[model samples]
Target: MDFNFTEEQDMVRDGLSRMVREQYGPEERRQLIASDAGWSKAIWGQLAELGILGMSFSEEDGGFGGGAIDSMVIMEEFGKGLVVEPFVPTVVCAGGFLKHAGTAAQKEEHIGGIVSGERVFAFAYAEPRGRYDLANIETTAKKDGGDYVLNGHKAVVIGAPWASHLVVTARTGGERTDAQGISVFVVDKSADGIVTRDYATVDGRRASEVYFENVRVPADALIGEEGNALPLIERVTDEAIAAQCAEACGAMKVAHAMTLDYAKQRKQFGVPIASFQVLQHRMVDMYTEYECSVSMTYLATLRLDADERTRKEAVSAAKVRVAQAAHHVGQEAIQIHGGNGMTDEYAIGHYFKRLTIFDSEFGNIDHHMKRHIALAS
Candidate 1:
């Protein structure tokens, strides 16, 4: 199979690369992170104008009809820049759910805002006790006269503080861990009885702990058939896992390159460290891990449209491999940079922080390993 990108995809990648290189230097990134919103609205608008935000959805949904590969390209570039934008939460997670499970009218109502960057979105699914289980939801949405009243707490909702809308999961029927009786609902972030406590994440992004105390939403707020959203949730979560792995691959590439550059410049014992054979071997190991990660990410991207079992297995495998690479590449990058790598002023440390966070998002290495084993056996 040809892993080569199409001309359009290449253009997209090049365009984003140029945007980040020219507009998002380390100091500029710091300023953006320190800003009240914790991200750059100008850059967000630029992405919308460039059509990057719409690249992952279908034309009927007012997008470019691009799929997993499109998201892979955009996210990898974003990773290289340490972009603090909510693209993953807004476009990948929430938009993926909308595209896969939303009704035509629902798609028409919300997708344009995402494509135009006029509205930010977030997926509020992770509960305080969920621990990577999609079905482990304690949030409940009880029917109440043409509406549903939601009540529960969502933990670490990335981008929620800035999001105008949220796609939330709630239990409508059975127990917390049951596959059935789960549903997805879209709620306005400013709705009555909704509360959020926002904070800056370690990786320079913003997330919030949101609470719903009898939050009421109209009947039209439901995304798909009630009590049957787990499959859609699972499929979209796998896509998110694949997208994040690709992002890690991009970060790993940058980390490896930066470490090599540092080795060439920093002298030790009156000689450049790159000249040391032992250090060279370590850099080589980092490069090998990066290469393997990229290959696995590509494989997972291609398998997104495969059968459910195959897709899940491929995604899990890629997540596990990429998680390992994140650790190895990040640590080696830090080691090569010495104590300077630990400081917030340097870019290397930020990359390492992002990689560390990437290890836990969606699923960690051990989590994916267990998932792959369960599916295979």
Candidate 2:
């Protein structure tokens, strides 16, 4: 099959690339990260104006009718910039849920806002005790008359500080960790009984430990069926895995390039280190790892619309490969750069930190490996 991007996709990629380059230089990025909001709303609005936020939704849903590939394209570019915008949470995760299972009213109310970038969303799924398991939810949503009272803590909620809304997962029927009882809802972040303690993440992004204390949401907030949301969650998260795998690929590509540049410049024994075959070999390995990761990301992206088993296998395989590649590429880059790579002033260090965090998001190498093995068995 042909791997070439369509003209529109190319335009999208080029447009986003220019945006990142023009907007997020190293110094600019630091300022944005150090700001009180930890991200740039101006850039967010620019993305909306560029139609990127609406790229994945259907025209009927007020989007550009793009799909997994569009997200892959956008995220890879975001990775290159170390963008802290919540695209994955707002567009990929929340929009995926609305696209796949949301009621008509839900879509009408949310998708337009999402496409316009007026309603920012963070996915509140990872509980304190949940370690990469989508079903391992301890957050509870007890049903009351025409509403649900939520009570739980969502840990490491990326982009929660900037989100106007949250796509949250909670148990509404069965016991904890039970697959059948897990449900998803779209909650207002400013709702009463909801509290957030925000912090800057190591990757220069902002995140929050979100607490829900008897937070009441109308029944209309529920996204899918009352007690059958695990499959929906799995499918959306697999899509997220694929998107992030693409992101890792972008970071790895940049990291490898930085290492190559550094090796060519930094003199050792009165000669550039790039001339050393041992160091050259290590850089070559990093490039190889990056190319392989891009291939795996493509595999996962293409398989998103496949059958559940096939999609899971492909996503798991990509996540495992991408995670390992991110780790190797990052560590090798650091070692090659010596002390310069360890400092906060260097761009390489920031890239390394993002790659390190990428491994843990959605699933790590071992987590995907085990998931792939279980599916194969």
Candidate 3:
């Protein structure tokens, strides 16, 4: 399949890139990182005004009726700018989840606010072990009279500190890793019996550890049918992984460009370092890795709605390639920047850190490699 972007998609990317460059340059990013929210609400509003925040949702939900590829385009631009906003968690993960699995009433109630950037949402799936395994949830939600009582903890819920709501996965029955009886709930952050310990993540993102001690929610809060959320969760996770791979690819491209410019300008011994054969070879390798990542990301995006086996294989392959590419490109960019690369004063250092965090999130290279191999066998 041809992976070329349509004219409209290209325009969307270009417009976003221009906006980010003008509105969220390196200094602006630094200031946002130092802020309490680790992001700018004004920028978020601007994105909403541009219709980018609602780009991937249906028109009935106040969105633009875009798809997975549309999300990938927006996320790539966000990654290029090192945006601290919770676009992926709110727009891609939560919005996609609701669009796919939520009842019509649920979509009408929640998605409009999310698409308008008036309400933020997060996915609380990881537990103390911090694995992305959907079935490893120890959080329990027991059925009560007209409600479900949730009791347990969620670890490292990204954007939870700023989220108005969360999509939490809890075990309704069976063992911790059993797929059976897994359920998803929509929980309000301000509800009684809920506690949150907020913190700044390594990449200047806001996250929190949330506790639900008998937190009660109505039966309608459960997304889709109870005990049948596994398939939906798996599908959303695959799309999330593909979106992240696209972001990583975009970040790697930016890092490569920044390092190339540095090499060309930072002259040493009466000549630009970029003129050196060894440095040229290193740059070539970085470019090659980035190309591979782009190819894999595009392939995975196209397969977002494919058959189960095909989707799984494509996403796993993309995640593995993107992880490797991000690592190689980050390291090479840092190397090219020399001692200055390790300093916080330089944007390259921050870019490298973000790349590292991205590789680790969703699923790392090793995790995807194992999945890919298992599927192959």
CA lDDT of each prediction against the hidden true structure: 0.92, 0.93, 0.88
Give a tens-digit lDDT track for model 1, residues 1-377: 88889999999999999999899888899888899979878888999999999999999899998989999999899888888888888899889888988888889889999999998998999988998899999999999999999999999999888899999999999998999999999999999999999999999999999999999999999988899999899888898888888888888988999999999999989999999999999999999999999999999989999999999999999999899989999998999899999998989999999999998888788888999999999
* Pairs in clash, predicted candidate 3: none
Selected candidate, larger lDDT, 2 vs 3: 2
179-221 in candidate 3: lDDT tens per residue?
8999998888899999999999888789999999999999999
Pick the winner on lDDT between candidates 1 and 2: 2
Over 296-350, each residue of candidate 2 has an lDDT whose tens digit, in order, gives 9998999999999999999999999999999999999999999999898999999
Clashing pairs in 1: none
- The deviation in Å at residue 195 for candidate 2 is 1.1
Task: Write down the TM-score for model 3.
Answer: 0.98
TM-score of 1: 0.99
**Each candidate: RMSD to true structure?**
0.8, 0.8, 1.1
**Candidate 2 positional error at 213, Å:** 0.7
Tell me the deviation in Å of residue 10 in model 1: 0.6
Q: What's the lDDT for candidate 2?
A: 0.93
